[model samples]
Target: MKLYFINEYLGDIHNTGVEGMWVYAEITPSKNIDKFNDFFAALVDEENDFEEANFSEEWVDDNNWFVIDDENRKKGICIPAVYPDGVIAWRWR
Candidate 1:
């Protein structure tokens, strides 16, 4: 099983009434997201702090994100999204 972590940052300029940040993680087949269709949904339940967040699939860069004590070795992939006020988003897949 593998853990996928996803997050989004809505910067000060978004003005979408979105603040702070979001984080989510789930366990699935290693390096194969196709094996876990319900992964994102599970994360919504797993990450109680960010229940309102959502996930979208895309290619992520490796420069904008990092793993903090990722014992599962699942933190590395980074999907980059540019938000207003230089906000950066990332997802580990």
Candidate 2:
């Protein structure tokens, strides 16, 4: 899985920034795409909040993740950004 961080502003407040990160996983002949999608979807749904979200200590130590806004706490992460190709589905954080 390839991870990308897209920096963008959230909510009406100016100067407050957040990362809209996405994961891109290539499906190959040996890969089970359905299972992969289901796993990621469930994981995202379960740990949608920044405070409640779980990440590896190594990942956290290496990279900065999402920052939740007070107003958008209920919005959660893992919004799907669909593309025409259908293979490139983004899990927006």
**How high is each candidate's TM-score?**
0.22, 0.19
Q: Which stretches of candidate 2 lie over 4 Å from their true place?
A: 1-26, 29-39, 46-53, 60-93
Q: Identify the leading candidate in terms of TM-score.
A: 1
- Native-to-model Cα distance after best TM-score fit, residue 23 in candidate 2, in Å: 8.9
For each candidate in the order shown, give its overall lDDT on alpha carbons.
0.34, 0.33
lDDT of 2 at 54: 48
Q: Model 1 scores what on Cα lDDT?
A: 0.34
- Candidate 2 local lDDT, 1-93, one digit each (tens): 222222433212122223455544332212323323433344345446433234344323313323334554523334332222333333343
- Worst lDDT window (10 residues) for model 1? 9-18
* Count of clashing pairs, candidate 2: 0
Which residue pairs does candidate 1 place in steric collision?
60-78, 60-79
